[model samples]
Target: MSARTFLRIAVSNTLVKNIARYVMMMLLALLLFGIILLATGKDPFQSYRDMFGATFGSAYGFSEVLVAMIPMLITALAVALPSRVGLINVGGEGQLYIGAAFATWGALTFKDQPAWVLLPLMALLGMIGGALWAFIPGYLKSIGLVNETITTLLMNSIAPKIVGFLIFGFWHSPMDTVKTENFVSAARLPTFFNTRVHLGFVIALVLLALFWIIMKYTRWGLEMRAIGGNPQAARRNGIPLKGYLIVIMCLGGAIAGLAGMSHVSGFYGVLILNFSMGLGFMGFLICWLAGGDPIGIFLMSFVVAIITTGGNFLQLTQGLPYAVINILLALALFVVLASPKFFEGKKA
Candidate 1:
């Protein structure tokens, strides 16, 4: 092909188009958010510079960004997996909470165990806890008794309360009424190179890779994609739709539980009451923005993590409210929603 033709062909490629669309959405979102900043009498350019510089200026700042990203990466997968089968799992928060609770129980009960023994046991317990919590909603959905979205969303509210009760009544530390004691060295996820970034970052990346592989190559992936495309058609093909529904939802929960486990074990080293600051919801937003693409999930999660870390910097440096980040995120989401066709490549 001629050079010009090659360039046009490359630009027209599906992957290239999707990437370009995401870039456009982000630019548009930033522009809109900048206007909002201007309207509020803030220096938008300076604010942008400060945010990016604070996040990228030092190795420590960048490591913190990764620390923030790990949870969202895992949680976004929690939402993304169920989505592949036409299931909407909005309870990643609850799943994460229940998972952490389970891991905490294991960590306390087996506090003296060696790292090799305790870590895997805690991870298994965390997965089981999240899966069980997710199962209630999954079962309800499978039998057509209720929608997964509503059940999962309602459960998100319940999970934290249950954690709160456990903390106050059974797991509280001597120094705090609303948090558990710090976990032993065995229970804590190993950190990297003296930075806050933990093993969860590796775990999240592995799960994301696994997700891509399963969805792209496996028979189950094929079936799930069929179901998502047309449920009635998939059912007619003897795909065992109900079983997939229940299993996949539970699996998604298991992943979310891992996120919870990582947060406590790696990030906090203690279970605190209401520790999650809408992580599940944020994951949901990332999944929506990425439209269930693995690469998109990673990119969007990183973008969000940068924004989140920058929000902290903005508060200290520019005297802006941390809540401003939410407004930016909302604008981005709105832009994506309003221009769905752009991402969908509808015209092409």
Candidate 2:
């Protein structure tokens, strides 16, 4: 092809356009955050250098980023699946907590079982816990009794408290009142590369692949998409809209539960009081930014993981508050939200 034709072809490629948009949005977010740092009399250049250096410049640092990414990837999928059917599942937080709680219970109960049996049992318990918690809102939304968003959000607050109650009153370790005893080896997920990275990483990747495959090729996925695009039309054509909404929400919760299970079993090795630190909400933000695309979720989750993992470097080396990471993330999200306009302007 001629040079001009090649250039036009590259620009017209959807993947290329999306990549360009994402890169520009990221740069804009970084630039805005740098200005904020400069306004606060900090050396933004040094801070930026430190951020990348601490997270992406070392093998251990990169591994830690992967560690941070696992739960966010899974939880983001939790939100993404429901969004496919036009269901807003804001209960990932609750689902995660409940899942952890259930997994913890299994760990304690099956302490003497072999790894083969115990690990799967714990994972199942976690999914059941999360799915059960999600069902309340799903059922309500299906019946038109309450909006899923409101019920799920409200349940998020309640779920943690229930977990707290369980821990304080029943499951506390003998030494640590705020956490359970360490999980037995049988109950823990296996790790690889002598790092904290565990089976959960593989699970996340498989889930992402499955998500992509199902959405691209499955009849159920087609109907779900139709429902999302036009619920009334879908219903008229015989799609079971209410059933899909309920089932999909539960599936999302199950995935979020797996995230919780991996967290407690593979990462923490014990359920600590209030250990989540807004992972569900962070996943929600990631899902929103990625527009429910599996590939987008993976990439955006990594970016978020970098920001979160680098937060400690900023606090210790740059003397910036840890909360600075949240501000940076917020700026990135805002930039993404405004990116459609940016693209529109480019077209104009």
Candidate that would win on lDDT: 1
lDDT of 1 by residue, 1-348 (tens): 479976885677886877788789888989999998999888999988988898999999999999999999999999999998889999999999999999999999999999999999999999999999999999999999999999999999999999999999999998999999999999999999999999999999999999999987899999999988888899999999999999999999999999999999999999999999899899988887777878778988988898889889878877888887888878877887787664452110
lDDT, candidate 2, 1-348, per-residue tens: 489986885578776777888889889989999999999999989998999999889988899999999999999999999998888888899999999999999999979999999999999999999999999999999999999999999999999899999999999999988999999988999998888999999999999999988987899889988988888999999999889889998999999999999999999999999999899998898887788888788889998888888888999998877988898888888888876443232110
Once fitted onto the true fold, the runs of candidate 1 whose alpha carbons sit more than 4 angstroms away are: 1-12, 342-348
Model 2 RMSD, rounded to 1 decimal: 4.3
What are the runs in model 2 whose C-alpha is more than 4 Å off?
A: 1-12, 340-348
lDDT for predicted candidate 1 compared with the true structure: 0.90
Query: Between which residue pairs do clashes occur in model 2?
Result: none
Q: Per-candidate TM vs. native?
A: 0.92, 0.93
CA-lDDT, candidates in order: 0.90, 0.90
The positional error of residue 5 in candidate 2, measured at the CA in angstroms, is: 20
